[model samples]
Target: MTRRIEQGVERGSRITIFVDGAPVAAFAGETLATALIASGRIAFRRDGRAALRGLFCNMGTCSECFVQTAVPGRAPRRLRACLTPVADGMAIETGAGPDG
Candidate 1:
Protein backbone atom coordinates (compact mmCIF):
# COMPACT_ATOMS: atom_id res chain seq x y z
CA MET A 1 0.00 0.00 0.00
CA THR A 2 1.12 3.57 -0.64
CA ARG A 3 1.59 5.87 2.28
CA ARG A 4 -0.08 9.27 2.30
CA ILE A 5 0.98 12.33 4.24
CA GLU A 6 -2.04 14.58 4.25
CA GLN A 7 -0.45 17.07 6.64
CA GLY A 8 2.51 17.31 4.33
CA VAL A 9 0.43 19.18 1.80
CA GLU A 10 0.63 22.93 2.14
CA ARG A 11 -2.48 24.85 3.01
CA GLY A 12 -4.45 25.95 -0.07
CA SER A 13 -1.93 24.18 -2.29
CA ARG A 14 -3.32 22.73 -5.52
CA ILE A 15 -2.44 20.42 -8.35
CA THR A 16 -3.69 20.41 -11.92
CA ILE A 17 -6.05 17.89 -13.50
CA PHE A 18 -5.97 17.70 -17.27
CA VAL A 19 -9.30 16.30 -18.38
CA ASP A 20 -9.27 16.34 -22.18
CA GLY A 21 -9.03 20.16 -22.48
CA ALA A 22 -9.62 22.10 -19.30
CA PRO A 23 -7.11 22.20 -16.47
CA VAL A 24 -8.68 21.79 -13.05
CA ALA A 25 -6.99 22.40 -9.73
CA ALA A 26 -7.29 20.10 -6.77
CA PHE A 27 -5.50 19.77 -3.48
CA ALA A 28 -2.16 18.01 -3.52
CA GLY A 29 -1.73 14.52 -1.99
CA GLU A 30 -5.30 13.52 -2.78
CA THR A 31 -5.93 10.37 -4.79
CA LEU A 32 -7.01 10.81 -8.38
CA ALA A 33 -10.54 9.83 -7.37
CA THR A 34 -10.49 11.86 -4.17
CA ALA A 35 -9.10 14.89 -5.92
CA LEU A 36 -11.53 14.56 -8.79
CA ILE A 37 -14.40 13.97 -6.41
CA ALA A 38 -13.47 17.12 -4.53
CA SER A 39 -13.47 18.88 -7.88
CA GLY A 40 -16.99 17.53 -8.60
CA ARG A 41 -15.78 14.82 -10.96
CA ILE A 42 -18.08 11.98 -10.00
CA ALA A 43 -17.09 9.70 -12.85
CA PHE A 44 -13.63 8.30 -13.18
CA ARG A 45 -13.99 5.94 -16.10
CA ARG A 46 -16.32 3.71 -18.10
CA ASP A 47 -16.59 0.03 -17.50
CA GLY A 48 -16.66 -2.57 -20.24
CA ARG A 49 -20.44 -2.20 -20.13
CA ALA A 50 -20.06 1.54 -20.63
CA ALA A 51 -21.21 2.12 -17.11
CA LEU A 52 -19.68 5.11 -15.32
CA ARG A 53 -17.46 4.05 -12.46
CA GLY A 54 -15.42 5.66 -9.76
CA LEU A 55 -13.17 4.60 -6.91
CA PHE A 56 -14.40 1.42 -5.31
CA CYS A 57 -11.77 -0.75 -3.68
CA ASN A 58 -9.40 1.77 -2.11
CA MET A 59 -6.73 -0.91 -2.30
CA GLY A 60 -4.67 -1.64 -5.39
CA THR A 61 -6.82 -4.52 -6.58
CA CYS A 62 -10.01 -4.28 -8.66
CA SER A 63 -11.05 -2.45 -11.83
CA GLU A 64 -12.31 0.56 -9.91
CA CYS A 65 -8.93 2.25 -10.18
CA PHE A 66 -8.79 2.40 -13.96
CA VAL A 67 -7.86 5.79 -15.42
CA GLN A 68 -6.14 7.09 -18.52
CA THR A 69 -2.98 8.96 -17.55
CA ALA A 70 -1.01 11.16 -19.88
CA VAL A 71 2.67 11.08 -19.10
CA PRO A 72 5.46 13.08 -20.68
CA GLY A 73 6.93 11.54 -23.84
CA ARG A 74 4.58 8.59 -23.53
CA ALA A 75 1.21 7.95 -25.08
CA PRO A 76 -1.88 8.31 -22.94
CA ARG A 77 -2.29 5.15 -20.88
CA ARG A 78 -4.87 3.49 -18.73
CA LEU A 79 -3.67 3.00 -15.18
CA ARG A 80 -4.97 2.03 -11.80
CA ALA A 81 -5.27 5.06 -9.55
CA CYS A 82 -5.15 2.82 -6.47
CA LEU A 83 -1.66 1.85 -7.57
CA THR A 84 -0.41 5.14 -9.02
CA PRO A 85 1.06 8.12 -7.21
CA VAL A 86 -0.27 11.51 -8.21
CA ALA A 87 2.41 13.92 -9.39
CA ASP A 88 2.33 17.50 -10.53
CA GLY A 89 1.35 18.22 -14.16
CA MET A 90 -0.29 14.83 -14.68
CA ALA A 91 -3.08 14.65 -17.21
CA ILE A 92 -5.77 12.15 -16.27
CA GLU A 93 -8.99 11.06 -17.89
CA THR A 94 -11.64 8.60 -16.87
CA GLY A 95 -12.79 5.97 -19.37
CA ALA A 96 -11.57 2.95 -21.21
CA GLY A 97 -8.47 3.38 -23.30
CA PRO A 98 -6.61 0.99 -25.58
CA ASP A 99 -5.33 -0.94 -22.60
CA GLY A 100 -8.65 -1.08 -20.85
Candidate 2:
Protein backbone atom coordinates (compact mmCIF):
# COMPACT_ATOMS: atom_id res chain seq x y z
CA MET A 1 0.00 0.00 0.00
CA THR A 2 1.14 3.53 -0.68
CA ARG A 3 1.68 5.60 2.46
CA ARG A 4 1.44 9.36 2.71
CA ILE A 5 3.10 11.75 5.13
CA GLU A 6 1.34 11.70 8.50
CA GLN A 7 2.87 14.68 10.23
CA GLY A 8 -0.55 15.95 11.30
CA VAL A 9 -0.80 18.45 8.51
CA GLU A 10 -4.33 19.15 7.38
CA ARG A 11 -5.23 18.45 3.76
CA GLY A 12 -7.73 20.23 1.61
CA SER A 13 -11.15 18.90 0.59
CA ARG A 14 -11.23 15.60 -1.23
CA ILE A 15 -12.08 15.41 -4.91
CA THR A 16 -12.36 12.80 -7.65
CA ILE A 17 -10.27 12.74 -10.81
CA PHE A 18 -9.87 10.27 -13.64
CA VAL A 19 -6.56 8.66 -14.58
CA ASP A 20 -6.54 6.56 -17.71
CA GLY A 21 -10.33 6.31 -17.42
CA ALA A 22 -10.19 5.13 -13.82
CA PRO A 23 -11.50 7.14 -10.91
CA VAL A 24 -8.96 8.29 -8.36
CA ALA A 25 -9.48 10.07 -5.04
CA ALA A 26 -7.52 13.24 -4.56
CA PHE A 27 -7.45 16.24 -2.28
CA ALA A 28 -7.60 19.85 -3.26
CA GLY A 29 -4.31 21.78 -3.28
CA GLU A 30 -2.47 18.55 -3.98
CA THR A 31 -0.47 18.10 -7.15
CA LEU A 32 -1.51 15.46 -9.66
CA ALA A 33 1.64 13.47 -8.95
CA THR A 34 1.00 13.50 -5.23
CA ALA A 35 -2.55 12.31 -5.66
CA LEU A 36 -1.47 9.56 -8.02
CA ILE A 37 1.27 8.49 -5.66
CA ALA A 38 -1.13 8.45 -2.75
CA SER A 39 -3.41 6.23 -4.80
CA GLY A 40 -0.55 3.75 -5.39
CA ARG A 41 -0.12 4.79 -9.03
CA ILE A 42 3.50 5.61 -9.68
CA ALA A 43 3.85 4.94 -13.37
CA PHE A 44 2.68 8.13 -15.03
CA ARG A 45 3.77 7.34 -18.59
CA ARG A 46 5.79 5.12 -20.88
CA ASP A 47 8.54 6.16 -23.22
CA GLY A 48 8.86 5.09 -26.85
CA ARG A 49 11.25 2.39 -25.69
CA ALA A 50 8.50 0.96 -23.50
CA ALA A 51 10.20 2.10 -20.33
CA LEU A 52 7.80 3.17 -17.59
CA ARG A 53 8.40 6.68 -16.38
CA GLY A 54 7.21 8.42 -13.22
CA LEU A 55 7.97 11.33 -10.97
CA PHE A 56 11.63 12.25 -10.82
CA CYS A 57 12.40 15.84 -9.90
CA ASN A 58 9.00 16.41 -8.29
CA MET A 59 9.39 19.85 -9.79
CA GLY A 60 8.80 20.99 -13.40
CA THR A 61 12.39 20.56 -14.48
CA CYS A 62 12.12 16.93 -15.52
CA SER A 63 9.72 15.54 -18.09
CA GLU A 64 9.47 12.07 -16.68
CA CYS A 65 5.91 12.53 -15.48
CA PHE A 66 4.46 13.86 -18.70
CA VAL A 67 0.82 12.92 -19.21
CA GLN A 68 -1.89 13.77 -21.70
CA THR A 69 -4.87 15.54 -20.20
CA ALA A 70 -8.29 16.37 -21.60
CA VAL A 71 -11.07 18.46 -20.18
CA PRO A 72 -14.61 18.92 -21.42
CA GLY A 73 -14.71 20.79 -24.73
CA ARG A 74 -10.95 21.12 -24.74
CA ALA A 75 -8.32 19.35 -26.79
CA PRO A 76 -5.84 17.09 -25.07
CA ARG A 77 -2.55 18.60 -24.03
CA ARG A 78 0.60 17.21 -22.53
CA LEU A 79 1.68 18.41 -19.12
CA ARG A 80 3.98 17.36 -16.37
CA ALA A 81 1.95 15.51 -13.78
CA CYS A 82 4.18 16.67 -10.95
CA LEU A 83 3.50 20.32 -11.63
CA THR A 84 -0.21 20.16 -12.41
CA PRO A 85 -2.73 20.50 -9.60
CA VAL A 86 -5.44 17.91 -9.21
CA ALA A 87 -8.81 19.31 -10.19
CA ASP A 88 -12.27 17.82 -10.06
CA GLY A 89 -13.45 16.12 -13.27
CA MET A 90 -9.99 16.25 -14.78
CA ALA A 91 -9.26 13.41 -17.16
CA ILE A 92 -5.71 12.19 -17.68
CA GLU A 93 -4.34 9.60 -20.05
CA THR A 94 -1.01 7.98 -19.36
CA GLY A 95 1.36 6.22 -21.75
CA ALA A 96 -0.15 8.02 -24.71
CA GLY A 97 2.93 8.18 -26.92
CA PRO A 98 3.99 5.62 -29.49
CA ASP A 99 4.08 2.12 -28.13
CA GLY A 100 7.26 0.16 -28.25
Candidate 3:
Protein backbone atom coordinates (compact mmCIF):
# COMPACT_ATOMS: atom_id res chain seq x y z
CA MET A 1 0.00 0.00 0.00
CA THR A 2 2.23 2.83 -1.16
CA ARG A 3 1.00 6.36 -0.55
CA ARG A 4 2.19 9.92 -0.52
CA ILE A 5 2.73 11.55 2.85
CA GLU A 6 1.09 14.93 3.12
CA GLN A 7 1.91 15.62 6.71
CA GLY A 8 3.68 18.92 7.26
CA VAL A 9 5.40 19.64 4.00
CA GLU A 10 4.23 22.39 1.70
CA ARG A 11 3.32 21.18 -1.77
CA GLY A 12 2.67 22.82 -5.06
CA SER A 13 -0.72 23.03 -6.75
CA ARG A 14 -2.45 19.70 -7.27
CA ILE A 15 -2.64 18.47 -10.84
CA THR A 16 -3.23 15.33 -12.85
CA ILE A 17 -0.97 13.36 -15.21
CA PHE A 18 -2.08 10.36 -17.18
CA VAL A 19 -0.28 7.08 -16.71
CA ASP A 20 -1.07 4.42 -19.26
CA GLY A 21 -4.23 6.36 -19.99
CA ALA A 22 -5.24 6.38 -16.32
CA PRO A 23 -5.38 9.58 -14.34
CA VAL A 24 -2.79 9.97 -11.59
CA ALA A 25 -3.01 12.83 -9.15
CA ALA A 26 0.18 14.79 -8.72
CA PHE A 27 1.53 18.13 -7.65
CA ALA A 28 2.93 20.72 -10.00
CA GLY A 29 6.56 20.29 -9.06
CA GLU A 30 6.73 16.59 -8.31
CA THR A 31 8.92 14.29 -10.33
CA LEU A 32 7.14 11.73 -12.46
CA ALA A 33 8.83 8.98 -10.47
CA THR A 34 7.58 10.36 -7.19
CA ALA A 35 4.00 10.67 -8.39
CA LEU A 36 4.01 7.23 -10.00
CA ILE A 37 5.43 5.55 -6.92
CA ALA A 38 2.87 7.22 -4.74
CA SER A 39 0.22 5.89 -7.08
CA GLY A 40 1.53 2.35 -6.39
CA ARG A 41 2.79 1.97 -9.95
CA ILE A 42 6.14 0.39 -9.28
CA ALA A 43 6.96 -0.88 -12.73
CA PHE A 44 7.83 1.98 -15.00
CA ARG A 45 8.67 -0.25 -17.92
CA ARG A 46 9.86 -3.67 -18.89
CA ASP A 47 13.44 -4.29 -19.79
CA GLY A 48 14.74 -6.06 -22.92
CA ARG A 49 14.51 -9.26 -20.91
CA ALA A 50 10.87 -8.63 -20.16
CA ALA A 51 11.48 -8.02 -16.48
CA LEU A 52 9.72 -5.21 -14.70
CA ARG A 53 11.84 -2.28 -13.57
CA GLY A 54 11.12 0.76 -11.43
CA LEU A 55 13.05 3.63 -9.94
CA PHE A 56 16.66 2.82 -9.12
CA CYS A 57 19.31 5.39 -8.34
CA ASN A 58 16.41 7.84 -8.59
CA MET A 59 18.63 10.87 -9.00
CA GLY A 60 18.69 10.16 -12.76
CA THR A 61 22.04 8.40 -13.16
CA CYS A 62 20.50 5.00 -13.80
CA SER A 63 18.29 4.26 -16.79
CA GLU A 64 16.06 1.87 -14.91
CA CYS A 65 13.10 4.18 -14.87
CA PHE A 66 12.49 4.90 -18.53
CA VAL A 67 8.95 5.60 -19.63
CA GLN A 68 7.33 7.04 -22.71
CA THR A 69 5.82 10.48 -22.50
CA ALA A 70 3.82 12.49 -25.00
CA VAL A 71 3.11 16.16 -25.48
CA PRO A 72 0.58 17.54 -27.92
CA GLY A 73 1.86 17.50 -31.51
CA ARG A 74 5.19 16.05 -30.40
CA ALA A 75 6.59 12.60 -30.91
CA PRO A 76 6.53 10.48 -27.78
CA ARG A 77 9.92 9.86 -26.31
CA ARG A 78 11.56 7.60 -23.79
CA LEU A 79 12.50 9.61 -20.74
CA ARG A 80 13.87 8.95 -17.32
CA ALA A 81 10.91 9.20 -15.00
CA CYS A 82 13.09 10.34 -12.12
CA LEU A 83 14.21 13.43 -13.99
CA THR A 84 10.92 14.42 -15.56
CA PRO A 85 8.53 16.70 -13.72
CA VAL A 86 4.83 16.15 -13.75
CA ALA A 87 2.65 18.57 -15.71
CA ASP A 88 -1.10 18.88 -15.85
CA GLY A 89 -2.51 16.67 -18.62
CA MET A 90 0.84 15.05 -19.35
CA ALA A 91 0.48 11.57 -20.77
CA ILE A 92 2.76 8.68 -19.88
CA GLU A 93 2.91 5.20 -21.32
CA THR A 94 4.06 2.47 -18.98
CA GLY A 95 5.36 -0.93 -19.99
CA ALA A 96 5.10 0.24 -23.60
CA GLY A 97 8.75 0.58 -24.34
CA PRO A 98 10.51 -1.18 -27.21
CA ASP A 99 10.83 -4.42 -25.31
CA GLY A 100 7.71 -3.87 -23.25
Report the number of the highest-lDDT candidate. Answer: 3
- Poorly placed runs, candidate 2 (over 4 Å): 96-100
Per-residue C-alpha lDDT of model 3 across residues 1-100, encoded as one tens digit per residue: 6487768889999999998888989999999999989987888988888788989999989899999976668888999999999989999888644433
Q: What's each prediction's TM-score?
A: 0.68, 0.85, 0.87
Q: List the residue pairs that clash in candidate 1.
A: 45-95
Clashes of each: 1, 0, 0
Stretches of model 1 off by over 4 angstroms after superposition: 1-12, 71-73, 96-100
Give the per-residue lDDT of model 1 (tens digit) for 28-92.
66667666655566577887889778778878777686888766778888877766756667787
Model 2 clash count equals 0
What digit string (tens of lDDT, one per residue) describes model 2 on residues 23-52?
A: 998889999989888887778888889788
The better candidate by TM-score, 2 or 3, is: 3
Which 10 consecutive positions of candidate 2 have the poorest summed lDDT?
91-100
Model 2 residue 21 CA deviation in Å = 0.8
TM-score of 1: 0.68
Best by TM-score: 3
